[model samples]
Target chain A: MSTTEAGGRIAIEVTVNGTRHRREVEPRLLLVQLLREDLRLTGTHIGCDTTYCGACTVIVDGEPVKSCTMLAVQADGAEILTVEGLARDGELHPLQRAFSENHGLQCGYCTPGMLMSAHALLARNPDPDRKQIRKGIQGNLCRCTGYHNIIAAIDAAAAAMREGK
Target chain B: MYPAPFRYHRAATVEEAIARLVEIGEGARALAGGQTLLVWLKMRFDEPTDLVDIGRLPGLRDIEQEAGRVRIGALATHARIARAPLARQIPIVGDCASGIADNQVRSRGTIGGSLAAGDPSCDWPVLLTTLDAEVHCRGPSGTRTLPADGFVQDLYATRLEHGELVTGVSFALPGKGSAGAYVGFKRCAPAFPTSSVGVQLTLNGDDCTEARIALGSAGLTTIRAKAAEAELRGRTLGAGVIAKAAAAAAAAAEPVADQRGSPAFKRSLIDALVKRGVEVARRRARGETVEVSHEYY
Candidate 1:
């Protein structure tokens, strides 16, 4: 029997992008599925469902993690950040604007995950150098743009955030 | 892919988690930094009936120094260790933790889980083996300490008993003028290491006072390069000495071929990593702030 039928969906409550949400979710339900399917916040992409690809990256409790690999139940009581929540007052996050201006993306399939990872990176390291930027987003992969633009975008975003832009 | 259907239980304490594991019977696993375990579940490599969520347990994820040794809690993430203050005492911890996988993996993978999972390709077990670290495990029967040297018995196997949880890992703080390095060969940014060498050396004016060499991804379990250690200790470290030690490490390593690399290729990597690890460690012993960023590409 499935866990839901045998017992019931586990009760989990999480604050996502400053919004409190409570739901009954399957213990097996991945966090990526909850965000993309249940919440209809499809910004998080899943290029490779395996641990790699970094296309399903999101921030849980202020740290970026692979949403596809993490179970929904594990996210209980945590604050999650998704690409859908990157903007405030209709203003794009510095990273979002930077990516757009610097051509940090090509196909953009990995944009959301890259943005999330970059957000977390900038949060921890506001003024990371090129080496640190390369290391910061090492988890993320961009099949297009050759990653130079992504690195430049993140670097520019860091500078913008530092100068209060 | 989705994880196979399994019930989840939350525990606030180690004792409670162990009790629940015993009550729930076998096929139950404690969840700590589910970086590897979740992947295993999604791949159907594991089918546990119960998953006791101990990720929120109190005081399990700390990096602290106690009684002349650094005690690392089970839940201490690689990211935490990579940036922890205790890295000053044990640089190898940060050296290895900083390069385990990628940011997401480092943000979630726990030191305890890595050691418990005992994947030969994992970082901590091999590095810990070099530091002579101790794994503190708590179970229903009682608590016991296992040396990292033999904690991993086989591939993906550990000496942990049923219902036992790795509480923390502790190791004696390296003394003054001590430095170490962990060098491993990976195909790219997100692949398991093919072969690695972790070296800890205490030098007294170019004469090696003590040396510990641990090889990873070279065999079923991380192997201690005893002959290599012997070659370094009590000897003046020079090109000749390092060459002999690297040769010893390569001789002791027994690599298996897979997609990561061939046996011959891994053996060559064994020699190269050992040599690089020793050089980096030597520079560190000389009070140079050197970070060995070896790239395969």
Candidate 2:
């Protein structure tokens, strides 16, 4: 039990948004901090930072996980997908477009978390009903919208995703 | 909310993990699923000198059937347990897994961690206690098994010794005509249950042949409502009988006043909750498939 500062820096290789980045980070560095600070992929927000809020939600090994609740070293050699990876070729993803069209966001603090959560839901269940949509994003707390439009956006996105729009 | 400095060691094997834990002694904590441990680290409430990352230890994530038992490896995530065929075969496990926090949390929270964390209000420890499951562990000495009831001693306390790793859990497969239900009341969907009841019983016609009743968020740890179970066993499950059993359970629990509810309120809630749990289990035991999913998970 040496009380030295986080032992020593360790090398880790993580593939984020289809690109691999290798860097040395402190053992205590959280995955969300690594994404936001070292890799500059700040889309993964850290609210509550204790995992009560899903603001730091990201896909690791094809599962949605709160990045704030994971160590950067734990994610070494793992593939991660953050909110920043939602769109491809400069076009907004269907969920992002649906959120905008349906007025799903107001203050936008929780939208990243909502988006990432909904993205994973749609990935697992492409056409979730309203009940399922609510269940899917229930972890992501949106203090602004009252969740009516967020639910509508996810519902609409489910339909569009099913229609291949 | 950044975690304080600590060395991390990813152990590829449980033996190596045990050795590292022994070397690091009390200063070492095993990192599994990183759901609860990471929270402690971020809050700086836990300052372990080293974390043995056992999240990827080989053969620790399988869910399979072994003879008359269903073996769920230590690393099996809640999501995996929820969707596993083994859980569906014993629906109570799936019901419990499906209602733990949310999908994201389920994807990260492991069954072993859930049981090892020993949260008094957590679904797995309480529900597994009712189902009479076993928790397997590996330490410097060797592998061992413990009943779920004794595995969790108190809130945030477990029977796990130093340098010990939970290898997996095995539960006796519920025999035919067996059914179970876990009913919980929460302020919000994602919130931990204020008063929850787990009832597993086997029915012969309308009579309860066997019964195991567990109540959570009602006391220090998940408690067995022995009086309640005794009231139901060998008795014909009528509305009156269920109500009496519910009352017995209410009288058996000792819920403290908390933000969730008042002591009296929780006791009253458990009365109705136990009734609902019994009714659902009765229905399932009668070969009725009742589809239920919580809003949060």
Candidate 3:
């Protein structure tokens, strides 16, 4: 067990939103911290800091995971997708557009996690029902209690995605 | 809420994992999905000096049927197990696997980690106990197997020693007319069940030839209610008989009052869950597609 100074840093290489990065991080540095603090990708919010809140949710190697509970070292050699990756070529993804059109966000604290989880869900299930959408985002919590609109947004996004939008 | 700094070691094989755990000594913890361990680490519940990452160990994630039994590798995530062909063959497996935590947690949480945590509220231990599963382990002494019925010895404690790691779990395939159900009640998807029941039965028409009843979140460890099971074995599963068995199961529970409910409340909840579980198992045994899971309010 080496101290932070004595143990030094472990090197890791990961791809985020189609970009690759190689950095040295402490063994205890959480994946969320690496994404937000080290990589300057502040779109991945940390709510609750515990695994329960799910605000730190991100897709790692095709699985939606609570980044707060995962160590940066554990995510080495993995591909990560965060909230910042939701847009392309300055155009909002269908999910983002649908969320705005459906009033899916209020205080916006839980929006990032909801978007990532929904993105993963839609990727796996191109057309999800209301029940499936609810189950998909059950890990994320919105303090504003605006889940109905979020579900609607996901539903709309699924429809658009199926139409090849 | 950051976990304290610790040395991290990634082991490519189970043998290497065991060796590193032993070398790192008592202050080392095996990291699986980190769905449970990382939470405790953040809370400073048990600060270990080293974490042996075993999440990427190959061959430990395989779930396959062999001969007369189904073997689930320790690293199989809950989400994977929930939709596996095995889960379709055994609906109880899907019921338990899909009802744990939420989608994100299920994607990372492993059956091995759930059982290793030894938490009474974890659904795997109770579900495995009902299926008469055997936990396989490997350590400095090579390998060994233990029955799931009493694998969890106490709260947050198990029969596992310092260097031992659960490699997998296997259970005999349920014969014809045999089925089981896991039923629980919780406040939300992420919350642990207040009280849950797993009921497995082999029935010939209305007569129950065999029964295994287990209660979770009802005691310090998952309780195998043999007395409750006796009330059903070799008996016609009438409403009256099921009520008696449910009552017996409830009486066997030693629930401690917490924010979930009072001890009396948990007993009543257990009784209801046992009845529901038995009914679901019976329906499934009759070739009915009945969906049962952790009811969230």
Candidate 4:
């Protein structure tokens, strides 16, 4: 087994939003900080230190992960997607447009995380029912809108994506 | 918030991980997905001198079937297990894994970590106990197996020693005429279970010959409903019999009151969920397809 030096800052490499980054960081630096502070990707916001809030959500290796709770060093050699990576050359992803047109955001603090969560859900289901969509984003806590618009955004995105295909 | 300063070591193999744990002695903690440990660290609830990261260990994240048993590596993520073909064959494993936290958590959290953490409200232990699963552990001394009943000792506690690491869990697959289901009630926090019930039954020509019922978030540790199992054994698994068995299971639970629910409310949920779980299992056993109710939303 390979072992790195203990009790010292370590240099690690990670792929974030289609870009490769190598940096030296403390063992305790969270992935959220590395994204926002180090890499200057402020799209991912931190709402709560606790994992309950989904504000720091990101896609790691094709799955949603809470950036606040994950150590930056631990994510070495992994593929990550922040909210900024959702668009393709200025074309907004269907989910993002759906959120905007359907009024899925009130305070907008939870929008990034909500989009990531919904992105993962649609990637797997393509066409999910109301309950599946609701359960898919259950981890994301939205204080405003009561989740009716959020669910509608996902539903509309799913329909649009299906139709576009 | 930053976690307290601690030494970190990443172990690429199971043996190396266990050796690191032994070297660090009692102040060492193993990190898998870090979903739970990271929270404890940020809160300063625990400050271990050394952390042994076992996420890089190969072959520890697989689900396989051998003969009549299904083996799941301790490192298998909840999402992987939930979507595993073998889990679908067993039914209960998939059901329980599907209900844990949500998409993100299931994608990162490992089955082994959750089982080793032994949170009373976690769904894996409750379902494993009902299915008579076996936990396999490895240490410097060698490998050992513990029955599910003996693996979990208390809330947030397990029988794992200082140098031990969970390698895998194995259990017999449900037979042709057997079925299993897990039902629970949750509010606000989707990760934690308020009251949960797991039921597995074997049907022999419309008669329930074998039954196992386990309830979680109702006691210090997940518990088996012996009286409820007895009530279902040797009887036809109809609505009336299932209701009686559910009542027996609920009566046997010793739930504690908390903000999520009161003791009495938990008991009532136990009764309601157990009946539904058993009825669902029975329907599956009979090869009848039933859609899950979306009434709770």
Index of the highest-lDDT prediction: 3
Q: Residues A106-135, candidate 4, lDDT per residue (tens digit)?
A: 999999999999998998999999988998
Number of backbone-clashing residue pairs for each candidate, in the order shown = 0, 0, 0, 0
TM-score of chain B of 4: 0.95
Alpha-carbon runs more than 4 Å astray in model 3: A1-7
Candidate 2 chain A worst ten-residue window by lDDT: A1-10
**What does the lDDT read for residue A89 in candidate 4?**
91
How many backbone overlaps does candidate 2 show? 0
| Model 2 lDDT tens row, A99-144 | 9999999988888889989998888888788888888887888788
Residue A8 local lDDT, model 1? 59
Evaluated at residue B95, the lDDT of candidate 1 is 78
Q: What TM-score should be assigned to candidate 3?
A: 0.98
In the predicted model 1, the residue pairs found to clash are none
Q: What C-alpha lDDT does candidate 1 achieve relative to the native structure?
A: 0.87
Per-candidate TM-score, chain A: 0.95, 0.94, 0.95, 0.95
lDDT of 2 by residue, B192-228 (tens): 7887888999998888989999988898888889999
Candidate 1 Cα misplacement greater than 4 A, ranges: A1-7, B293-296
All-Cα superposition RMSD per candidate: 2.0, 2.1, 1.6, 2.0
Task: Score residue B212 of candidate 2 by CA lDDT.
Answer: 93
